[model samples]
Each structure stands twice: as C-alpha cells, then as structure tokens.
Target: MIQNTVPGATRTQAQRTAATRAKLLDAAVDSLVEQGYSGISTQGIAKRAGVSRGAQLHHFPTKESLVVAAVEHLVDKRLMEILESQPDPEYGFEALFDAFTGPLFDAALELWVAARTDPALHAAMIQLERKVSDALRTGCLEIMGDRVSPDIIDLGIELARGFAVSALMRTPESDREFRERLLPVWKALVSK
Candidate 1:
C-alpha cells in the first residue's frame, strides 16, 4: 500500500505511513536527547509529537520499538549528512575522516554506554550498525574511487566504533589525553 508521491506515479499508503513513522521517529530522537532511553516514555513521545498514544502505538507500541525507531532515525540522518558533505569526488577519504571526527562518534558512544544494561537498546544498535556500515562502505568507495576495499571500510567502521566506546571511559588519564592517544588506533586502521 505504500507508494511514492511522484508526478506520474500513485502516492501509496506506504509513503504516507513512512512519513508518519518518520515524524514519530524525529520525536523519539528528540526524546532520547532530552532523556536517555530509560527516561523516555511512549506517552511522552506521543504528547511531544501531538499525536495520540494510540497513534504512536500504531508504529511503536513499546519502549523498545520507540528506541529502535530513534536509533534508525539517528543513523539515517548522520549517514545522509556525511554523504551530502563530500567536498568533491576527489576528496572521498576526507569524508570518512569527517564522519569519524564528528557528532556521529559522540552519538554512538552515548548509545553504547546506555545500551550496556539495556538489551533492547543493544539490539537496536545492531540495526544501526547495518545502516552505518553501509553508508561508510558506500561513502568510502565513492571517495576512494576504486582504491579502497569494502572489507577495509568495514574494518574502519568497527575500529572507529570501538575507539569511540573506549575513549570516553573513566580512566586515570583525562579525556583530552585519551583522545590524544586515540591517534594510534586510527593510524593502525588507516595505515596499510
């Protein structure tokens, strides 16, 4: 039933549903930013979106569902932004650097910390991994323009995500020190 509203094509119910789903998704992300997963509630999301609880329930009836939607939304927004920001086709690897150095890393780190005890959040992250992974892979290939392998791109994503988790941990060293030390890991990943 879902279709794209195009000039000549039929606008299917699915498109409408997807748009509504995205609305709730944007709201859920706002909620997560306001309150971590544990602090967000279905009713709160519904109210913030100006939709009834039942309407929210139509897409995500439970906290896990809402969390999943929000995670998906976050991943998509980030990937799109990264993809859209290509300086030029010639500077593709720079895109990868830009992605790892920015908000995407912080956002994922926050989720990783919160998901340690929350299975639903953890599982939702798996879905996010797929999206992020694909975006990284495609973005890398586009920038590398036949120089980089998808396998290496995948490895880069994995290593970057791991660094994001470890770098933000409580340690005797200061956060700045930890970030300064993060270079070796990045060096290991990109150096071939």
Candidate 2:
C-alpha cells in the first residue's frame, strides 16, 4: 500500500499561504484607508482580516514591512484592473489607453503625494511607478521599434504623467477635463 505522499498537499500549502497573504493585504488596505498610515496596528489589521494577531505578525513582522506590502498590493491591483478592463480588441488601443490612464493616473498621483511624507511608502510607490513605466516602454519599443525611438515614447509618457499630476491637484470638474484632454495627445503620439 502506497502512502499518500502526493504533490497535492504541497499545492494546498502554497494555496493557503497565498490566501493568507491576500487577507493580510486586504486588511491593511482597509485600515490604511480608514485610519491613514499612523493609525494602523498589527492587531487591528488582524481583526480586520479575521486572522490571528500572531499570523498577521508572522506574515509581516514589522509595521514598515506591512505598509510597504500593502502599498505594493494596492498598486498591483490597480494595474490588474486596467489590464483586465480592456474592451474587445475591435475597440483597439485608443480605448485601452484611455481606460488605463485616466483614473489610474489621478489616484496614483494622489498616492504619490501621500507617500512623499513617508519613506517606506515612497519606496513602495516608486517601485510600482517604475514597473508601470518599464512595461509601457517595452510595449512601445516593441511595436514602434526604430521608427519612433524610445526617447520619443519616453518624452510622451512623461508629458502624460505630468498632465495626470496636474489633474490630481485640481477639483473634480477640472480633473475630468484633464482626463478628457489626454486623448488628443495619445492619439497624436501612438496612433498610426
């Protein structure tokens, strides 16, 4: 009789670890959004996540570590939302660009402002921003190649990010205008 030493148990262990991580991140977000950076405690997060305090601490031994992971998770979720929300391919890159930029840019800029005052959060935010920029540059270079050049794409991206930063500084009405205005710039730069 063979003992049940199947790989399934290992896979289950990995799944449980992932689920626990997600729960911790979720709890951290809720706490941070509600209480800001200073107000969150590990016990509070554990209660929010419905996990044990020891478990929460085990996953994130330091407050700084927890905050950094929370920020990164938030940024990653933002990217996934944009990537998943793409309309049918027939609608094409124009729609895809609009969907990804408008809301994401505004929120990201606001988060950047908040992060500026906190070193751990600043590092986390910077890492996410660089990831997005690198991904964009890679995609643009692959499609446009030598014809357009990386410098041109880089410049345009900076310009768009500038516009988004300005939008976050404005009132809601003006923020809407900021998003609407970017379409022309995007079309000119990327459209064939």
Candidate 3:
C-alpha cells in the first residue's frame, strides 16, 4: 500500500469534526443576521461556511438543530464577552446598555420575530432565550453589584432593550443625543 501523506495533519479527527461544527454554527448565525429566519437553510449555511453538505448534515441533522445550536453558540459567545469586559466605574450602565443592544441582540431579535409564526422555532427560541436572559442578568449583577440594586438592574435591562428597539428609527446623531439625555436618568435610578 502506498503510504498516506498529509501535510501537518496534527489535528485528530475529533478536532477536525469540532472545527467544522463550529464553522457551521457561526455561519448559521451570520445567515440569521443577514437573511433572517425564513431565509436560513442547511444548504445555505453549509455554503456560507464553505463546508460540504455531508459535513453539515453529519453535524446537525435538521435545520432546527442547526439554528438552535447557532443561537446557543451566539449567546454563549456574547455572554463571555460581556463577563470578561472590565466594568467602567462611572460608565458601567452605559457599557452594560451597549452590551445588551449590540449584534447579539440584533440576531436574537431576528429569531424572535421569525419564531412568532413558527412553532418549532418558537419552542427552541423560548428555551434558549431564557438561558440568555439569565446569563445577562447574572453578568449585570456581577458588573454592577456594588453600585446598583438587583431590581434596578432588571429594570435597566428592560429599559435598555426598549431603547435599543426604538433607537433603530433614530439617526445616529439623534440616538447619541437620546442616550446622552437618558444616561443621567438611568444613573439616578440605579443609584437609588
């Protein structure tokens, strides 16, 4: 038999498999953000990831599984980022608001909107949303434990989410002014 020759090839089969799975999951999130839920499909995800369909199928047998896994992966990544950031003593609330309103929320909002009509997607999202929410709450507590009450943290989260949703309609300049006006209010509320 001819000897097999593969350059490097240090990664085991399992490592390769995990790397492919991660690629697929990341592509799924990109699809959700770019195309929304209705536009997402296994084939599209595989194509986006530059992986073979067989590899995608082997990793996630169904579209639901793929999307759910992507959502979980995205949430975990965002939570870790939030948890790792240094909390600014004076601007902690601003930092937290920015964290909650970034790309992670955009991806999640897309899923939530799509889930409203799709029962299977809704079920998957509901379970994952709770976990994401809890992780965010815990992160907030950790970041603001000394300065803010838990109840205020909860309220601030709701306020930030609402502001994020509403800010979509405002111009960047107006949004900046809006946040500037509201930051003091939020600081006062949390300080109590």
lDDT of 3 by residue, 29-80 (tens): 8888888778888999999999999999998998878988887887788778
Reference-based TM-score of each model: 0.68, 0.63, 0.88
**lDDT of candidate 2 at residue 10, scale 0 to 100:** 46
Clashing pairs counted in every model: 3, 0, 0
Q: Would you list the rank order by TM-score, best first?
A: 3, 1, 2
- Quick one: ranking by lDDT, best first? 3, 1, 2
The candidate that achieves the highest lDDT relative to the unseen native structure: 3
Candidate 2 segments whose C-alpha is farther than 4 A from its true place: 1-11, 84-111, 114-126, 136-149, 189-192
Candidate lDDT scores, in order, read 0.68, 0.64, 0.81
> How many clashing pairs in candidate 2?
0
The C-alpha stretches of model 3 lying farther than 4 A from their native spots are 1-7
RMSD of 1: 5.3
lDDT of 3: 0.81
* TM-score: the better of candidates 1 and 3: 3
Among all windows of 10 consecutive residues in model 1, the one with the lowest summed lDDT is 101-110
Instruction: Tell me which residue pairs clash in candidate 1.
Output: 2-14, 3-12, 92-143
Report how far residue 37 has shifted in candidate 2, in Å: 2.4
